[model samples]
Target chain A: EPEVTQTPSHQVTQMGQEVILRCVPISNHLYFYWYRQILGQKVEFLVSFYNNEISEKSEIFDDQFSVERPDGSNFTLKIRSTKLEDSAMYFCASSPPTDTDTQYFGPGTRLTVL
Target chain B: AQKVTQAQTEISVVEKEDVTLDCVYETRDTTYYLFWYKQPPSGELVFLIRRNSFDEQNEISGRYSWNFQKSTSSFNFTITASQVVDSAVYFCALMDYGQNFVFGPGTRLSVLP
Candidate 1:
């Protein structure tokens, strides 16, 4: 079965440095999303992207965060400046054409900022 | 606001035992979707099942079954005769028509031999 895949399974970055997490969503899916889970915390939604635009975002997705679908298959999340609290697992998910379609998740990228 | 609750933080069962994971949700939208995902120690979140608000039917597949109760706003999952392979962290999630998705704190299951 086809699955969502992410690059840089684990990353370590210095505080105040920029970081980019990349994902290749399942081909043929139309909607994409980014979510984060702090260690020992619930998964929290960050932003959703469709049609090359942001569909929705959470308060946690503030000025530092941005998502891009630079190519057909590549979706990426960039943090302009990392903070210590940014250490967490970031997941990328994609859904089919329908709004109610089931969302498929990727393995996740563990981001560690020090 | 949409929220999902998985009250049980962790559960341990011997192999061949049956175990149930509870999920409750809060949503104001009349139409919504509920889902379950399993994450093994490997850290990949695998989709298990999805149930819509309109469907109250109980579904069974292999040793896994799901109970969807609109009245209680709950969607619970059960594994029968579970094996060690069933050990994983399971999460319940809710999404409204507006595309707001929320996930509960996962329940970690450990099936020992």
Candidate 2:
């Protein structure tokens, strides 16, 4: 089965540095989303992207965070400046443009900022 | 505000034992969706099931079953004859028509052999 895939399975960056996490959603899917989970915490929604634009974002998705579907398959999340709290497992998910509401997720990218 | 609550923070079961994970949700929207996902030690979120508010049907697939109760606003999952491979943190999530996805703190299930 086709699945969402993310690049740089693990990333380490210095605090205050910019980082980009990339994802290639399932082919033919329409809606895309980004979520994060701090160690030992519940997954928190960051933002949702559709039609190459942000559809919705959470309070945690402040000015430091931005998402782009620079190409047909590549969807990327950029953090303008990483904070220690930004260290977490970032996941990408996509749902097909259908009546069903299932959103398939990718193996997360573990971001570690020091 | 939409919220999902997984009351059981962790559960331990012997191999071949049946385990049930409890989930309760709070949502004001008349129309919404519920979902369950499993995160193994490797930390990948695997979609297990999805149910809409209108459908209160109980579903069974292999050793897995789901109970959706709109009256109590609960969606519970059960694993029958679970194996060691079933050990993982399972999360229950809710999403309203407005597309706000809220996840509950996951229940970590440890199936011992």
Candidate 3:
């Protein structure tokens, strides 16, 4: 089965620095999403992208965060300025345009802001 | 508002035993989807199963099974004869038809020898 793939499985960065997390969604899927989980907390949604544009975002997705599908095969999440609280595991998911199809998730990028 | 609650924060079971993870959700939308996912130590979210509001049928797929109760607004998962490899965090997600996303809060399960 096809799975979403994320690069740089783990990243340790200094606070106030910028970081870009990348993901390659399934070949034919159109809807993409970004979610994060603090070490012991629930997974939280940040943003959703469709047709190369953001369709929805949560309050947690503030000015510091942005997402881009710069190419047909690559989806990226850019954090302008990282904070210590931003340390968490970031996951990328994608699903077919059909409402009933299941969404495939990547292994996730573990971001640690020190 | 849409919410998914996995009340049991942690569950410990011995090998060869059966375990059930409880998940209760709340959503007013007439059309929605409920899903179960597993995240082992490797931290990869594996899609386990999916069920829609319109289907209340209980489904069993080998060692995994799910019970969907529409009236009670609950979707529960059961694993039979669990092995140590089953140790992982399980998540329940709710997705409304009108929305473009899913809401998840997971339950952690530990299998002992």
Candidate 4:
């Protein structure tokens, strides 16, 4: 089965530096989402994108966070300035237009902000 | 407001023993969706099951079964004859129409051999 895939499975960056986490959702899926889980914490929603635009974003998705579908298959999450708290497992997910309620998640990118 | 609650923080069972993970949700919308995901030691979230509010049917797939009770707003998962591979953290999530998924604090299950 086709699955969501993310790049840079493990990323280490200095605090205050910018970082980009990339994801390639399922080929035909329309909606995309980003979620994060701090170590030992519940996964938190960050943002959702459809038609190349942000459809919904949570409070944690502040100014420092931005998502872009720069190309047909590549969806990227950029953190303007990484903070220690930003260190977490960032997951990308997608759902087909017909089945928006069921999302398929990627393996996740472990971002470690030093 | 939408919320998902997984009351059991952790559970332990010997191999072949059955285990159940509880999930309760609060949502005002008459139409909503519930889901369960598993995250093993590798830290990857694996999709397990999804159920909508309208379908309260109890479903069984192999050794895994799901109980969807809309009256109590609970979606529970049961693993029958669990193996060592069943050891993982399972998450229950709730989502309203046109909204993001609200995940519950996961329940970690340690199936010992």
Interface RMSD of each: 1.9, 1.5, 2.4, 1.8
Over 4 Å off in model 4, which ranges? A98-101, B98-100
Among all candidates shown, the one with the greatest DockQ: 2
Docking quality class, candidate 3: medium
lDDT of 4 at A6: 98
Best by TM-score: 2
Candidate 2: tens digits of C-alpha lDDT, residues B1-113: 98899999999999999999999999999999898989998788888888888888898989999999888999999999999999999999998888788999999999999
Residue B57 CA displacement from its true place in model 2, Å: 1.4
True contacts kept of each: 0.62, 0.78, 0.60, 0.62
* TM-score of model number 2: 0.94
**Pairs with backbone N, CA or C atoms under 3 Å apart (clashes), candidate 3:** none
Error of 1 at A29 (Å): 2.0
Candidate 1 residues A11-82, lDDT tens each? 999999999999999999989989998987778889999999999888799999999999999999999999
lDDT of each: 0.92, 0.93, 0.89, 0.93
Please provide, for model 1 over B1-113, each residue's C-alpha lDDT reduced to its tens digit, 9 standing for 90 to 100. Answer: 88899999999999999999999999999999888989888877777888888889998989999999888999999999999999999999988888788999999999999
lDDT of 4 by residue, A1-114 (tens): 898999999999999999999999999999999999999999888999999899988889999999999989999999999999999999999999998867899999999999
Question: Where in model 1 is the C-alpha error above 4 Å?
Answer: A98-100
After best superposition, candidate 1 residue B110: deviation in angstroms? 0.9
Each candidate: RMSD to true structure?
Answer: 1.9, 1.5, 2.1, 1.7
lDDT of 2: 0.93
Clashing pairs in 2: none
Q: How many backbone clashes does candidate 2 have?
A: 0
